[model samples]
Target: MGADRVGGVRRPVRAVAYAASGVLLLAGCASMPDSGDLRDVESTPRQDSQLRVFAMPPREDAPPAEIVQGFLEALTSDDPQYATARQYLTGTASGHWRPEQSTTVLAGGPDIQVDRTTGHDSGDDYAFTLTGTKVARVDAQQSYTPMVGGYSQPVHLTRDKKSGQWRIDVLPQGVVMGQSDFQRNYTSVNKYYFASDTWANSVTSATAVADPVFVRRRVDAMTQVVRSLLSGPTRWLESAVSSSFPAGTALRRGVASLAPDDQNRLTVPLNGKASGVGREKCREMATQLLFTLQNLTPTVDTVTLQRTDGGTLCSLKEDQTETVATRGSVKQPDYLYFVDDKRRLVRIADGGTAAVAEPVPGALGEGVQKLSAAAVSWDEHTAAGVGYDGKSLFVGSLVAGGALDAPVLVSQGKAEGDRLTAPSWDARGDLWVADRDPARPRLVLLEQGEGEPLDVRVPGLKGRVDAVRVAADGVRIALVVKAENGSKSLLIGRIERDEKAGDRPVVSVLELRSAAPELEDVTAMSWAGDSRLVVAGREEGGVQTMRYVQVDGSTPEGPPPAALTGVQSIAATEDEQLPLVAYSSEDGIVQLPSGAQWQKVTKDGLAPVYPG
Candidate 1:
């Protein structure tokens, strides 16, 4: 047996997992007797305090896990030089292990956590061993970031008998982490992933799918990501999963099946205890996959949709693919239309499909499949994610500009299989899109009568345009572009003043650099105001937040995505301070000010039409 097996036997040893089922509650298994006696106690101690501090030849009373965590936090602490490896060690980690080569190293955030800590002794020598869990976000995965498992080795230090203080005892030549992590630490984002499952259950209560087996598969897939080992392999697997199961593998497999919403033992507990137990053994490690963004060409096609009411939503005669033909009937997994409650199609995309699922054991009803056949058209080329209209309904691509039969222009040119995320419009009737057909993915003004874009050019931009935001007055356009070497730049230009760069509006902010330890969030830019640029993202929530950074270098902290979740259908409010008004894809519209509270507009009995 290995030391891991022996160590697990004497103390609380968690199951070595790389994954489980629906409502999969993650639990640790211990080799220690009466492992059931353990509870999440307040006295469990902050793992950091257990560090074995280093002194003189280097040694102190502490656990290596805590020490290593501390070192990781400190090394990445921000010095401009610390942007790369050699710079960090020269300024931080260089005191010990010095690397002879100059290199550029990439690091993801908050993946490793010391789950259970203990001390190991070998005769005259002693060390602190930390058995923890870690997950990594690498480019290798099927999705954005696939969760996996990891292990940290024992760190060294001598017991300090004289002074009660635990000082730095020893470091392994050099540590693997930096200083910033220590300065800012919070695992709240990690906590929220599981919580999202609960929220998903609640929100989707009315609309239920009856498949259980397929649900189990998805749940297991998530377990694989969550319990995956932290490494490059896991990253590759995430991309694969995200590509293969764009509908969210975890959401599909975990909830409806293992812990079906049905009134059985699974739903009875609600807390997921039953669900977690049943799926523990079903943990699935990530399956490796390799893909890249290849399909950037827009293939246009026109198809008529059959709304649930059996009414002709529209002739559907539109799309750049052809002159606009109409399909008499709609089919499954073709197009997904995000419609308002009143059935106004706001956003629509093709190519992506829903996950396959199986009915739960004894959960199938005598009534049979009650769900209506989705009438929207989708295929396997584009994934147009809809934007939620916080006030009235969700903006779907199918109904933008009140034209169900509007010409569908498929801006095709994205990595094959990569979910080139597109925006769902708000109640404002605008679809934010990036297309290469115009030779610029930069912001283009899309309107009912506008034959072509008015040539909205951002001031002094130098590369492929990733995103564009328009102001309330339609004057400002904010864009983000990735410079070589993973550096992000924020560019804000006057759009209304000069939609076409012919007349350059006062270039407010040319370039605002990021101080983030990880540049993942600011890689693409979105417009928050006519002049103020919002640097943020979705998916990786905890690491990024909504903040106001202007072209003039003045900034203030802003609301989190969760907080702004209430403010949908965001449109520039025009007021410098009151920057945006969010239209609800559901009920009412929300007005957003720079520091103002969100306002609603539902007095006028405006009904929403959900996009099919």
Candidate 2:
């Protein structure tokens, strides 16, 4: 789901010229270099072929069971049109089999057992049953759904009269791949969709949102990605989001000859149904194609839409557009702020080296001397911090004449390690905090004005809530909880505001889901983009790693970024360009700009932060 369906906050878009109307995306982790050195280092061959092709065909003299096993293994290959996998089927059966209908992802290699009936003839002697645990299912429409249960696929084989070779004659459509094979062959990609523009013709105000879908890297990826985008959002998001393509919209030539021109401009010809759409609508459709194809081919800088007759529909330059309505539109601030060795608030320009990160001209920046952990508000006007001793929480203005006001909240820890977490502010101006008090653990929310802080009830949390960050949408909250074994877990919970009682604002958590259950320890997390989070956690070995996870509890495929030892805290924003900033005890402040490699920004910095 995109930002539009997040928290029920209707994120509208604004359509402008090509340059300002585009959406920004950080380079994806799925696509690795096509070729690399293999002599001195271990490496897996990159899968870049147009189809899944296999090296061997069905053995001509093999038994029915052997042929069945060969066909199953071939399904996992990059065989063109699955021609090799089809070799185990009769010519007629091969033509009728539809591998694109659906996919069944299993937990492990299938357990296949041969079965032969008593009265079966020579050709009728081939029958088998496959058993395994179903991990997930990708329906014919390409919507993925996680599931858990027993799966059984029955296969029947018959002798081909012409070749006298054993071949499958009865089976279901689509294919099945084991967990290990699936991980190596398939990669996830996000398709872009736009929210309905409330002011389309006059001044467009709807933004594009990314809907992630999986595709085989060695298969027809470009065509599949485009077709999925045109088909619209998945079942879960359709109610909350809208698409720009008109009803009955489709490709003109259907992914064939869909190539970029000499200037690297992608020419997409649609059917006659799209010819009647308005100019603005055509531009919106073009934006969708540009973002969807970005991962496939970065050389495409513009998209030209055409009709079947080759008449031009609309064209959009890549640089002239921006995805203004989604969370990606929250551009990075002029500088990242952090506390220096002197315990004072300081700032640095985005790319580093513009100037030393000097203290700002405000109370917290110039006046305050002692600080431990802190966070800045979205507008950069206010700052919240924990006292040097970690017992008190204070809030003050970051403006020129602001003052370091008295502590607004405090906690009495039973031990030196039980302290309050860095306070985080949401878009609605509400501050959230969690006190790791063994005796009285609580998660509280503070409204701007002079009202008593309200405690949020989380039903299923096992231990103390260590950290709480409210999403920009104000409808979801991420919590880092410390379990009884001292390990930490990262969880995402839905924030439900009770409106029936009119006395005061009441918020509670209903459906809490484990966002990164595989990680052993979760240290920190921040909203990287709409519906996506960047988390700092450690696997079983206890080595720190960073990963990107969806709020829906699904993790993308890829190894974690390079290790950063002693990361005390990490910060990220909805802006995709800001990068992942962390405060390391060994190196002070370090930033992973592309989420792949880390670089030092400053040695004197302590708690680095970007506006939430």
Candidate 3:
């Protein structure tokens, strides 16, 4: 046998020595055998190259156990509308079943144990229990939340008198499948909304925030995503974001499909609730739709929102999208700043090839005060730096002759290791930093980089916050927390603000959850996109590596970035087009440009960062 090359991989090929016999068999392959009783030959059920799954219906007079097993297999298959799965259920049960309500993912396939006490031979009714370890869940809003614990459910069946066939009369709500099956059936998508806090300040530049959710990959994905978006943000994000669609807004009744036209324009038909919005507000709605859909289907060049009456309410093109809501990707950074060997702030052109680094403007760059770490404002107009001793935090302008202001915030931690972290700026111009004082550790927020720092309350935090980075959307914050055992973990929390009549608004971080549960030590992390982060960490008894993880606790497609050694600090921007910069002990500061290997930017630089 000779070897064959498939998709660049070589594999052994079996050879048939009977050349004449093989030729005859191939020629007569279409002919069927004669003089034999005809019977249906079922093809093997399997998934094809396109990832489409096929399932067969239950055989006639199948046992109760087989019926339950067949139904569970059908749930994992990509049967559009899940028509075959309903065949295993009774008439009433099928009508009431709502598979789209939610999905329960188990660690592995469920274990079915027949209840012996039910006495299978005594009557037509049969009972069985399904048990497995719980993994996570995807709610109706398509939000995925990681969970831990056991799962147990009961299923009851009865034989129909007319056909004498067993069918399920009682079943669990929604669908339950193993973790591997869930990953194959669903894909993550980001829904867009406007930041409520940014809009509340009457700011002209509106920032678009991403609300990530999961949707079926092969089952009318376009329509499903549009409907999810119209349903408003998820429960966890409802307080921090606002939707442009009016209350009670939804897709027009009887609308079953949505797609783009030849010119790549998508026209969405909404119910009467959205028909009366003003022109300005309608444009805002279209902008949200445009950004959300573009992420799913990049070919969609424009979006025209239509009212129930089929009249155009508003239309927005790809180029005009930024005018309504600004995204981090739309803003390009000018320079990549880092701390040099002398503990001074310096920067190089963001995309330049030269290795030369120049001192930044202002006193911090003039070597007036040595710095250990620094964060640049999103606007690139101001910079915040932590002093070498890590006891003081300084803010200054990035212009010539700009005086270094006195420490706007200071830490009283006796040890240098237990001090302030590098500062981060949100889209609203608010600064965020964590004070690691053992006596009084707290997360603080400074409004517009001035005024007294407010103690941001974290309701469920159990460990000390070692680092902090606020998303550009200004509503989500990522923290690296160190537990009492000295192990570090990455968590994503929601930032909520409550405004008062005459006093500053109250801020609190709520609903904290693990973003990297598998990693035992997270050394550095940065917001790489709207709802994605680039993390550098390692598992227990493993070496360090860098990977991308979704804020929802799901791993994104593709392998992790090229591995680097001794990474002390890592930096990335919301705009993924820019190269990634990291400070490594072996290579100093290096940049990984798109499609290229790591290149040294400087010999003795650390704490590399892009604006925000």
Candidate that scores best on TM-score: 3
RMSD of each: 24.4, 11.7, 8.2
User: What digit string (tens of lDDT, one per residue) describes model 3 on residues 15-111?
Assistant: 1122224321121111111211111111122222254554557677766666776687778766778898899999999999999889998877666
Give candidate 1's error at residue 131 in angstroms. 4.5
Deviation in Å, model 1, residue 448 alpha carbon: 14
**Model 1 residue 13 CA deviation in Å:** 28
Alpha-carbon runs more than 4 Å astray in model 1 = 1-558, 561-568, 572-578, 585-587, 601-612
Give the lDDT of residue 489 in candidate 1: 50
Each candidate's number of clashing pairs is 122, 23, 0
Candidate 1's displacement at residue 573, Å, is 9.6
Cα error, residue 144 of model 1, in Å, equals 13
Displacement of residue 270 (Cα, Å) in model 3 is: 1.3
Scanning candidate 1 in windows of ten residues, the lowest lDDT window is: 288-297
Per-residue error (Å), model 1, residue 261: 64
* TM-score on alpha carbons, each prediction: 0.28, 0.72, 0.90
Candidate 1 clash total?
Answer: 122
In model 3, the Cα lDDT at residue 274 comes to 94
Error of 1 at 96 (Å): 6.2
